[model samples]
Target: MLLQLDIFNILIQGGKGLKPLAYRMRPQKIEDIVGQQHLVGPGKIIDRMVKARLLSSMILYGPPGTGKTSIASAIAGSTKYAFRTLNAATDSKKDLEIVAEEAKMSGTVVLMLDEIHRLTKPKQDFLLPHLEKGSIILIGATTENPYISINPAIRSRTQIYEVKPLTEEDIKQAIDRALADTENGLGKMNIELSSEAMTHLTQATHGDLRSTLNALELAAKSTAPDTKDGKVHIDLAIVEECLQKKALVQDKDGDAHYDVISAFQKSIRGSDTDAALHYLARLLEAGDLISVNRRLLTIAYEDVGLANPAAAARTVSAVTAAEKIGLPEARIPLANAVIELSISPKSNSAISAIDAAIADVRQGNYGDVPDTLKDAHYKGAEKLGHGTDYKFPHDFPHDWVKQTYLPAKIKERQYYHAKENGRIEQAFKKQYDLLRQAQRK
Candidate 1:
């Protein structure tokens, strides 16, 4: 209990402006929120609730610096509700009682609970009655998925919303706002952020606005003032220093981006596990998740097809899991996918078969459908000779009755040539060879 109060008090330190620049710049209204337009955009859930005067408990889950706490703060400010901050991991039951007493006196209080995934049963028990009676609105913030990490009792009471990571543009807007806001920002310092520095600040942090803002502050404060212009200049070097990451030019539009992506896929195709992982790490460091996910999925069906069918299927599943969780933890599922794909026997036979079929079609080589294979359900179809001489294989032993099925012009056409590259595909080839022999009759 004593430990809990100590940890909680440490976070609740000092007057406004004394805290971090990120804390000072928290949105005071839904309009002031920098990102998370899905939640606070026009006609969105949080915006709609604010506009409609329908306040409810909600759990905001996402990667950090994506405006979970800012949303809670904005809701309180806009609704004119008394706001209090607590740590579910550190704050105790007594802390909940304090918020409840305040809520009772003030009609309603907005309790922004950080790390709500760590809420103890005692603290939850103390908060439940107030939450039920509408005296306290709980805005639980967590990086973990609420469904998996939070207790069901609390989970059942709150609307769970996933906060997406901010885009480069969104982070740029926030940095611009911080640069220009005279009251709560560094506007008075005459700090000039170079365009190169701005790009690094926005893109290199992987959309972490808190890290971007603080790093901007550090760069501005640490650099000596320019004597000629009387302005503090923050350049790319200083930003790289503060961020502790080299600004690798990994923009989606650049040639380097495509180069990295090509190397990543080719490495896996060549069955170089370590090399593939190295490229994956580079892409991840550049925060190129979309491309990583996209390329991996494409490789599954295109490169790793019949050789290891289950591995291909699992690549899709791994990518889905990675997207749901987001990064740096997203790396885990992505890594699993990368390792499996790199070492798995590789093949492009599926794509090869499709390409062959497509080429023939493009050349206008697809002949008319055989009469026996044509649609025969309509009343006049059989009279048109469409269903004539068709053999229903289901009635025969082994379901092996065979007949001429392909069109006359392309009766000998064979597009899918099964490979014997791995155990699975070898088994597939064995069945395929058997079917081919039977079809020749």
Candidate 2:
């Protein structure tokens, strides 16, 4: 009992002592949490779960600095569970075994696993039984999407929730909490942050609360108090010194990756050069050249199809060059491809026409092949009237004789609705219409 009391005292003292500001100011309760309103706001899913003490195996996925681990910790605190933390990058199977053993003795253990995506397959397999038996309520936290990075067996056992970046107001509330709470924050310190300093840190961190807190801590700890007032004044200059260039929130393997690629293709289709280039740069910076190549080729064929065949051909060449040259230098050719495709005339008619025909076929609309259209190369094909009405188009002017090519059911169905966007497709529309007219006559 004395030993337990001593450990508890030490924990209490630690919160008031030399822990980093970010560590000290972590929310201990759900209400104390400053962001992730969608998860913890009034009547939110997480709020209800924690309130009912019904914590289960959950995977929290989001960008860095979005309180995933903190929320897990808060849930454990709220539910009065024995909290245990582990880093999948460093902890091994033995560590998991120890945690599971402890949970067997304790009522419940809230195991918050950081970078759960990095958990080895063996370790994840080991954790499966513990999770099923409820010995440990696993709270897996990762910046990567669990569906993509986690083993299927493990992902199937957990509920996945996405925690997005905090809003500016939420971040500000967090900062205020840190400054006002004397027990676990910088409230005890005589420090005053200028308005400009607040704005600088808030804007520069780009919704990353950890980054904001760390910068605030650095400026607080390093700056000396003014001799006149005996208070540390954190100004814009100090903020500038502490703030580094923050990259945009991007998950190369998660939903953001697909979202960015989708936007890039749409931008090209809509002829928005600037937006297309922006998304191109994002992919390049993330070193996702493979996705870049695939998305660019898809855009070329799907969006730029039939409208500008030259652009389509050029996009293929650019992808080849990108593959040959590789990144850093490769982004140049990729950017050129994106720009060219963005400005090129857009057309979905070709794909739409094929898809319409395919849909009909899928719905049991298969029609018999026209006797004239059927091949007569077989020994007995002539006896079946296969080539009886077949016209040799080469024997006519323009190598174009009116003939029934389509299946009889869809022979006259207008499938190809050409959009007059570019010169090539325009010329194609005229010639194609003339051919249809000739066949009707």
TM-scores of all predicted structures = 0.72, 0.61
Show where candidate 2 strays beyond 4 Å. Answer: 1-17, 246-338, 341-441
Stretches off by above 4 angstroms in model 1 are 1-17, 249-259, 269-278, 284-302, 310-340, 347-422, 426-441
lDDT for model 1, please. 0.86
Given candidate 1, what's the lDDT at residue 316? Answer: 90
Query: What does candidate 1 score on TM?
Result: 0.72
Model 2 RMSD, rounded to 1 decimal: 11.9
Per-residue lDDT of candidate 1, residues 143-184 (tens digit): 888889999999888899999889889999999998898898
- How much is the lDDT of residue 160 in candidate 1? 93
Residue 274 C-alpha lDDT in model 1? 97
lDDT (CA) for every model shown?
0.86, 0.82
Q: Output the lDDT of residue 18, model 2.
A: 62
